[model samples]
Target: MAEITDTALQGTSKSPNTITLQEFNNRIKRLLADPSVMNCWVVAETTDVRINQHCYLQLLEKNPKTGATVAKIKAIIWGNQFRFLNARFKQVTGRDIGNDMKIMVCLSVNYSPQYGLTVVINDINPEFTLGDMERQRQEILNRLTQEGIIGQNKTVPVPPVLQRIAIVSAAGAAGYGDFMKQLTDNKYGVCFYPCLFQATMQGVKTVPTVLAALDKVEQNQHLFDCVVIIRGGGGTEELNSFDNYDLARRVATFPLPVIVGIGHERDITVLDYVAGIRVKTPTAAAEHIILQAANALAHIGDLSNQVVSIARDYIARAKEQLSYYAGNLPIMAQRIIDTNTLRLQNFIQNIPLHVQRRIEGENAQLARQKDAIKNAVAQVKMKETMRLEALGDKIELLSPRKVMARGYTLTTCEGKIMTDAAQLEAGKLVTIHFRDGKVVAGTQSVIKDK
Candidate 1:
């Protein structure tokens, strides 16, 4: 440590005094080392919290209304103290010191020539943060109630069979894996189509990423029957984001029913209140869906059995009807045959007498027709004989022998008979014939009549 002088503390601009960096820091250290102000409790919001072997962070005291920082200080916790304080805080509040956390911490002011001013945190009042968180949560609940949206999702009906699911979760989280495993390996062999919309489930990004995931699910709402927000296997610090007003409101009014299972039994968030269905763990959410599907399947099986029973009953009735008809068929057929046989016997007895009467009448009618035919044939023969005799007389009057006998002579030239002078030539042979004689002579010159 360097020496401090009175001149360094009181100096004019004309003769300015200088002090070594270590000397200046040593003076500040002495002032802060007072017993009254050395170790005390301060309430502030945590910021830039980094935890490892030791914890390093900033404490911020802000104006309540404006939310502008009024005081800021560098703070840290040594490895051993941080372990004890964090363990105790987690046990009490279900959370460790995290960014934006309101805390009342017991700290001692420290200054070093090399390290400047910083507060060393020794213990924390977990109840203070816990109370503040509860107050904020209540305020959110009141706002949601006033808006009348806190029970909106609860009003949506979960489908009897939850086949398609829109899941908002960290893709690789142990909770998501456990949920999928339980659904896949259920004893009832139920199937689920769980499409994951990945989001950060913890830390500063939790609220926005989850809200974005819900928006995506909304855009494709037709693909899912319900929404499942599952963040299994995370500490209570991670659960704080689920209490956010914006995230809770979004879940409460989402179009599809939302199921929240964040894997915490001791701590419940505002989300649990707003969600349609809330369960302790991802496995429980899976089991709920499986049970619904199993019930629906059982219902379907029962309906199928009922249909089979009805069909069997119908078939049994049809068989009885057929059997009744078969038993009466032979008697009905025999009665019809006996009636027809009696009618045939009566018709056969009248057949011979009817034929005999018909034959006698036909024979008398034939005798009458024979006499009429004989008269017609005799009249026709007499008419034809008179016509033939008149023809013979005409033929006798025109005969050549008859003409010659009546003094009409016939002349012939060689074998042809000549009736004209043009048929005769000088010195041609001629023949003249009378009734019973013929003369042959040499012809003289024939003359034409003038």
Candidate 2:
């Protein structure tokens, strides 16, 4: 046998010859950088994936058949490739590829003769990414349904306009930017005052960060009209965080209506089910606001038009009434004039004729009265003359001279005509009266006139 040298001979030295855990891990990382035995494709279920600040990932894969884990690998995704991968995954699936996702990845195997083994990812398939997202989505939906939070958010009332908005999203996501821009640019005079409750929009920390933001919004309840959870563009994997039962409960029981604009068109999440309104994208949510405002404006315009029409109708009616009265005015004036003129003409025609007729009748009556007076005076004069003539005749007949001429003598006694002889009895003295003269005689013989 060859002489045992210091290098060849084995001895249990006082100090151990093996490397420390830290040094071994560093050597394995260095070996992973080699090009030969490291390159391969892995189809595995990611049980755990932790992303560090430096963009390195720790991945663990498990076997689905045995329910036993078969591979554990330390993986790295450089910042540039990580960003591209993240963007691409989100563009395809509307989510981020993270833990609990089954992926077929192109990786480089890293083995160190001194240390251990690891893997580094180079490329990813987007279809597998969507598959992973659908699986997680189903799981979350089942969980939320079991917990009774899915139905609650659907029952909330959505305000006509979400004027005060509490937004939970990554601070500078394009979706958030688009939403804000659309709201601000609204033509319907809608004003949105958004309270930004920033959070991680993707990855393992998304659920906790978003929940924290929601809690903050809840605490400051006076600041918001409704809550909006928006992720502009991301893989559906990121939406898995929203399916958490606790998060769903928080959204369902929020003091205000919660509006979700997750921008994933393929499937609805538990958060969507719980929200008062679910919009497919941030821009679509903005469009809803615009539509509401447009409707209000149209209603106001209709009212204004109706008011104007009513006023116009009233004016027209008043004008028609005025025209009716105006048309009747001339007829009324003509009737009054014609009535007065006819009365005047009748008076004028009757005045002189009535006066002349009355004067003629009076003249005829005066003539008749004059004729009667004349007749009465004549008759009285005639009667008086006749009586005088008759009286003269009687006097002539009774005259003494006439009696004498007729062979008759008159005798009288005591200067009175003697009509009886008996009155002359042996008287003392007697006088006789004749018609012309009287005589006094003594009685020689008594004689009687028979």
**Top TM-score prediction, candidate number:** 1
lDDT of 1 by residue, 1-450 (tens): 988788976764665798998888889988988987666889999999998788999999999999999999889999998999988998888877789889998889877888787789978899998899899999999999999999999999889899999999998899999999999899987778999999999888999999999999999999999999998866787888888999998999999999999866765889999999999888899988998899999999999999999999999999999898899889978988999999999889989988998999899999989998999999999999999999999999999999999898899987898989998998998889989999888977888998
Go through the candidates in order and give each one's C-alpha lDDT. 0.90, 0.76
- CA shift of 274, model 1, Å: 0.8
- lDDT per residue, candidate 2, 1-450, as tens digits? 778887754564576688788887777667667666555777765654555543455566666688677777667776678788867876886656666667777887765656456456788787886776667667766776787766676676766556787888887899889988998998767677887899998777888888899889988987677788888755555566776766777787777777888855765777787788889998888787678768877988999999999999999999999999899999989999999999999989999998999999999999999999999999999999999999999999887798876656677665666677777776546765454575677876776667
Count of clashes, each model: 0, 12
Quality of model 1 by C-alpha lDDT: 0.90
Give candidate 2's TM-score. Answer: 0.49
Q: Local error of candidate 1 at 374, Å?
A: 70
Q: Estimate each model's TM-score.
A: 0.63, 0.49
Error of 2 at 70 (Å): 9.1
**What C-alpha lDDT does candidate 2 achieve relative to the native structure?**
0.76
